[model samples]
Target: MSAAWSAGCVRARSMLSRRVGAGGARELASRASLEEVLQQLAAGPYQRGIRPGQSLEDAQRAVAATVLWHLRVLAGWLPREGAESVRALAGWFEVANVVEQVQQPGTPPYLLGSLAVSWPRLARAASPEQMREELAASPWGDPGGSDPRTIAVGVQFAWAVRVAERVPRAQDWAAGGAALLFARERFLAEQPLAEPAVRRAAVLLGADAVGSASFADLRARLRGDARWVLSDVDGPGELWRAEVRWWDRVARDALKLLRTTGFGPDVVVGCAVLLGVDARKVRAALEISARGGRPLEAFDVLA
Candidate 1:
């Protein structure tokens, strides 16, 4: 391995070591109050993002911010191509920023800093049309049209494609995510598939799958690794489990990647995914704690 790859892999593993493991997260959930949860987090890697007495939404965003910061640090340790791959994975933040910009322009955007694909330019967009134009000019490509919903969905599909193209190992992850997106629109939200979404789905999952008439049909249309994400999902109410299963699958695959790969981008990517999974588990645990639910209650959604 090159010196940069070696250093980056080392940094990745070090960052992974700092995660609050599944057991630790469950323990946090078992705490008596959010106060106790916050106290526990203050002594860990989350201390930088979390604070005393923050609302659940704010606290979750803080956790996400901290994870993004970690990704930025990891990216700094890598060479050009590896850093670009990290940046591709990090595009989800940029996608969130854009969606928030369209849905609630007054909301303050997440500070993406060096990991941004086009937030610097997109932030200045005064209208959805301007945002669409800015995205077309940037790495995100055209958002189909200026409709806020279309723009939101377009950017997400674009992010998935970017990840698949830039980090080949993440192809299954990207496909699985896109399949879930389709399921959400069709089953959970019960909204008709818009033209832009249909086009994107056709491109991502193929023509036959895009024409799925129901959730069962959609799940049946998926092949190979992408099909497994929806294997246990039966209906809209069960969609949450599909998301939970997605996280579980990601953690499992990422761990395997970490074990099999040496000093390379795969190691860095695996580490990044694991960090994301840990952060998500922590956030879920905090949610359960805030609700005064038992720790075991969290395992249903978290396990």
Candidate 2:
């Protein structure tokens, strides 16, 4: 392999290992290599193209071809029963046409609740065809199979926090899990989607950070308490609106309740119940930071 291709593979492996679990790492890495091959073919000779910068659309399409190839190749690794696994990864990738078709830009805010339901099953698809069939079976239709290449850019565009939420707890080095949790928030904020539930995932993920959200998701979460109705959030490079009426309600009058807090331990564990993030990851991270370093933390890291 050329040095450039080799380096790209290395970068792909490192990121995939972080994004997916160790179980899927090698396969994901190999798929990334194959993706580079596909991209070179589709974009013309890779060596010649690199000397001169390509147009934005060309660069975008090339990167997209890489993401689709990886998605298809990685999904191929699953067992017949691994549909759920494949589906989750696909959800992590958040194919764009699905996002665009389902959501509108100006709607109520929302959270990850409804969106999270699809992820586990989405990750389970055994092949690209299977992935396409699965999404088609849902309300989203078959965005992948109909025009796989055309939509891959949209897929990369849509991934965001939906991907970060999938990171297994064992991957985080910090005991507090703060870094990974923080990372998830940042990813969503960085690529905040128009979808409310997805937007809420980022909002619930971080407090001081920025991200966009439709009012629908925000209102859905605000079924109760409130000192405030809406707040400005930071997204990719700008500020967007989010509502926190309920959060303010709990923080102000309902503050004394031990179980009421959303940002602390019990809440984190409860979030684990809802979000499927391993509590050990969060606890381990907290402990590591608190103690500076220890054996249990290492064991948790290994977990």
lDDT of 2 at 277: 24
What's the alpha carbon RMSD for model 2?
Answer: 18.1
Per-residue lDDT of candidate 1, residues 1-303 (tens digit): 799999999999999877999989888888767878888788898999788888888887888888999999999999998899899999989999999998988877778788888899989999999998998898888877898987988888888778878899998888888888888877888866657567766666767887888888888888565777788788767888888778777888899889965799779999999988888888888888888858566555664
Model 1 vs truth, CA RMSD: 1.9
Q: Which model scores highest in TM-score?
A: 1
Q: Model 2 shows how many backbone clashes?
A: 41
lDDT of each: 0.84, 0.32
Question: Tens digits of per-residue lDDT for model 2 on 117-153?
Answer: 3544544554555555666565334444333332232
lDDT for model 2 comes to 0.32
Candidates' RMSD to native: 1.9, 18.1
TM-score of each: 0.93, 0.27
Candidate topping lDDT: 1
